[model samples]
Target chain A: SQQGEEDPQALSIQEGENATMNCSYKTSINNLQWYRQNSGRGLVHLILIRSNEREKHSGRLRVTLDTSKKSSSLLITASRAADTASYFCAFFSGGYNKLIFGAGTRLAVHP
Target chain B: GAGVSQSPRYKVAKRGQDVALRCDPISGHVSLFWYQQALGQGPEFLTYFQNEAQLDKSGLPSDRFFAERPEGSVSTLKIQRTQQEDSAVYLCASSLAPGGFDSPLHFGNGTRLTVT
Candidate 1:
C-alpha cells in the first residue's frame, strides 16, 4: 500500500503543551500534506510540504519533511483544547494523481 | 463563500438496498474526489473527477460502486446492493485545480450510511 503510517496512534496533552506526530511513507512522493478532523466533521487542510523542501511553518504549526528517510513530522506549539482532533498525513506519489492517507493520530488536549 | 456541500447527513438502509449520495463542490472548482471512511480509520480513496471527466477510479472497491459528475459541478455516488461493509462515511472534496498537486482540498461534512 502507498498509504503512509502515522506514529503514536493517540496522544494526550495539556493545554499550552506541544504535541508532535510523525508519518512514514513507503514510496517517493511529490508532496505531503497534513489535515485535522474534529469528531463527526470533515477534514481541514493544515499544511503542505513538497519533497524538495525540508520544513514549512504556519501559525502554531510546523511541518518537517525528510525525503532521505521518507518521513515527515507535524508539531503543534502551545496546543489548546480546541486543537484536539485526528491528524492525518497524506502524500502523492510519482504515478498516482490521488493523495493516499494514513490511519490518523488522535490528539487530546485537556484544559 | 460556501464550502463543499453533501446532502442527507445520515441514511439508514436495509441490506441489498441501493443508495445514492450527493456532493456539491465549491463553485468553479475543477477537481472532485470521493472517499470512504470506516470508523476509526483513515479515509480511503474511491474516485476522482476533473471537471465532468473521471480521470482515475482505481480506488473504487468494486463495480457495485458508481460515480459521476454530470456538469463538472455536482457529483453523485451510487451503490448497489449495499452490505454491512458498505456502512461508512462518504466524503467529497474539491480543489481549485487538479488534485495531487499543491492545491489543498475543500471537503464536505460527508454523509454517513448505515446498512443493516
Candidate 2:
C-alpha cells in the first residue's frame, strides 16, 4: 500500500475561509512533503516537514507532523479561489530515495 | 535547463499497441523517477534511475512497462501491448541527488496516455 493516506477526499469552502487536510502514514519516515496539483497539470511542491520537526510554516500554509501517530496536517488560512486544487502528501523514507504519494484531497475554493 | 520537460503531452493508442513517452530532466540532475496516476488519484511510483543506472523498477505494474535513461539525462518510458487499464497520466520527475533530502523532486507537466 502507499505510505500516505489523506482524509476528506473532497472539500468545498467559501473564499477567505480556512481549510484543513489531514494525512496518515503507516511507517517511519525521513520527511513528509505537501504538493498541490491544478487540474491535470504536474504537481507543485508546497511545504515539507521533517521527522524531527513538529511544525512548519510557509506563507499562509501551516504543516504539522506527529511522528508518534504517523500523521500530518496541512492548514491553509484565508484561502482564495486560486487555492482550489488537489493537494497531496508524499513521504520520503529513510531507507530509500523514492517518494510515495497519497491519494490526495480535492479542495474547491468558491469565489 | 528549465524544470523537467516531457513530450507528447497527450497520446491516444489502440489496445495492444505500443507507445513511448519521453522526458528531458533538468541538466545536472542525477535522480529521475517515473510515476503513473489514474483518474482521481495521486501518482504511483513506477521506476527510478540514478544517472544511467536503473536502481529500482519494482513499481512497474507489469512486464509490458519498460523505462530507460541512457546517458543519464533523457528518459523514455515505453509500454508494449497496451491495455485499457493502462490508461493514465505518466509523470516524470528529477532531482539533483540520490538522497533527495536536500533537493525535492521537480515534476514535469506529464503525458496523459489513453488506451482505446
Candidate 3:
C-alpha cells in the first residue's frame, strides 16, 4: 500500500515563482525523499530528509519533515521551465527497507 | 563511468509469455532497488538488493515476479507468464551506501513494459 498522499494534485506557476507541494503519510517513517520526473522518463532524486531532521536544502530544492504530523513539504525556489515535471514524495517506513510513494504532485512551470 | 541504466527502453509481450529486463547500477554502488510505476501512479517498490544479497522482496506483487542481482552490479527482473496487469514502467536504482536512511538512490530511465 502507498504510505503517503500529496495535496493539490496539480499546480501551475510562472517560471520565477516558487512552487510548494505537501505530502502526508500514515506510518512512521525513517526518511522521506523527493523525486522529479520529466515527461515519461524515470525519476531523479531531488532531496532526502531523515525523520530526525527538520529541514534540508540542495540548490533550489528545499525539503522539510515534521515527524509529529507525519508530513513533509517540498519547495522549489525561483522555479524554471525546466522544473516542469511531476514531483513525488517517497517514504521509507521506519524499520523497513522498502520505499513507498505517494500519488505525486504535478508541477508545471511556464516561461 | 556512468549512472544506472536499464536495457530495452521499451518492451511488449503477449500474455502468458516470459520476459526479462536488465539493470546495470552505477559502478561501486552497494545498494540496488527495483520499482514499478503504473500510468498516473507513483513508483512502487518491487525488490531491493544490498550487494548481492536481496534484503527485501515483500513488495513484489506475486510469484510471477522474480529479480536477481548476481554480482551486485547488474540485476535482472524476470516475469513469468506475464499478464496485462503487469504493464508498467520498471525502474532500477542504486545508491553508494547500504541499509540506511542517509543514502540517496540514483535512478535509471526505466523500461516501459506492455503485456497484452
Can you list each candidate's DockQ? 0.71, 0.72, 0.73
Residue-level error in angstroms, candidate 3, position A83 = 0.6
lDDT of 2 by residue, B4-103 (tens): 9998999999999999999999999999999999999999999999999998888999999999998999999999999999999999999898845556
Instruction: Please give the range of 10 consecutive residues that has the lowest summed lDDT in model 2 chain B.
Output: B97-106
Scoring only the second chain, what is candidate 3's TM-score? 0.97
Q: B1-116 in candidate 3: lDDT tens per residue?
A: 58889988999999999999999999999989999999888989889899999999988999999999988789999999999999999999898888535777888999999988
lDDT of 3 by residue, A1-111 (tens): 687899879999999999999999998777888989998788888888888899999999889999999999999999999999999998777445687789899999999
Q: Which docking class does model 3 fall in?
A: medium
What fraction of the true interface contacts does model 3 reproduce? 0.75
Q: For every model shown, what is its TM-score relative to the native structure?
A: 0.97, 0.97, 0.95
Model 1 residue A21 CA deviation in Å: 0.3
Alpha-carbon local distance difference test for all models: 0.92, 0.92, 0.90
Question: Which runs in model 2 stand beyond 4 Å of their true positions?
Answer: none
Residues A32-57, candidate 2, lDDT per residue (tens digit)? 99999999799889988888999999
Clashing residue pairs in candidate 1 are none
Q: Local error of candidate 1 at A104, Å?
A: 0.5
Model 1: per-residue lDDT, tens digit, B20-90? 99999999999999999999899988899999999999889889999999999999999999999999999
Lowest summed-lDDT stretch of 10 residues in model 2 chain A? A91-100
